[model samples]
Target: GARHGINMNGKLQRLQEQEERIFSSSCENLVEQIIEKKKKKKRKTIETDE
Candidate 1:
C-alpha cells in the first residue's frame, strides 16, 4: 500500500506539472496573438492618416 501510494503521488505531481505547462503556453500564445492584432491595427491607422 505504501508503494502504491507513492506511485500515485508521483503520477499526480507529474500530471499537475503538465497541466500548468500547457496552461501557460496557451496564455502566451493568446497574448502574442493580441499583440500582433494591435500592431496590425496601428499600421493600418497610420497608413490611413498618411
Candidate 2:
C-alpha cells in the first residue's frame, strides 16, 4: 500500500508538470496571435489615414 501511494504521488507530480507545460505554450500562442492582430490593426489605421 505504501509503495502504491508513492507511485501515485509521483504520477500526480508528473501530470502537474505536463499540465503546466501545456498551459504555458497555449498562453504563448495566444499572446503571439494578439500581437499579430494589433499589428494588422495599426497598419490598417495608417493606410486609412493616407
Candidate 3:
C-alpha cells in the first residue's frame, strides 16, 4: 500500500510538471501573438500617416 501511494505521488508530480510546461508554452505563444498584432497596428498607422 505504501508503495502504491509513492507511485501515485510520482505520477501526480509528473503530470503537474507537464501541465506547467504546456501552460508556459501557451503563454509564450499568446504573448507572441499580441506582439504581432501590435506590430501590424503600428504599420497601419505609419502607412496612413505617410
Candidate 1 per-residue C-alpha lDDT over 1-50 given as tens digits, one digit per residue, 9 for 90 to 100: 99999999999999999999999999999999999999999999999999
Among these predictions, the greatest TM-score belongs to 1
Q: CA shift at 36, candidate 3, in angstroms?
A: 0.3
lDDT of each: 1.00, 1.00, 1.00
Q: Which ten residues in a row have the lowest lDDT in candidate 3?
A: 1-10
Residues 1-50 of candidate 2 have per-residue lDDT tens digits of 99999999999999999999999999999999999999999999999999
TM-scores vs. true structure, each candidate: 0.97, 0.88, 0.94
Candidate 2 regions off by >4 Å? none
Reference-based lDDT, residue 35, model 1:
100
Candidate 1, run of 10 with poorest lDDT: 1-10
Flag the better candidate by TM-score, 1 or 3.
1
Per-residue lDDT of 39 in model 1: 100
Stretches of candidate 3 above 4 Å error? none
Better of 1 and 2 by TM-score: 1
Candidate 1: C-alpha RMSD to true structure equals 0.4
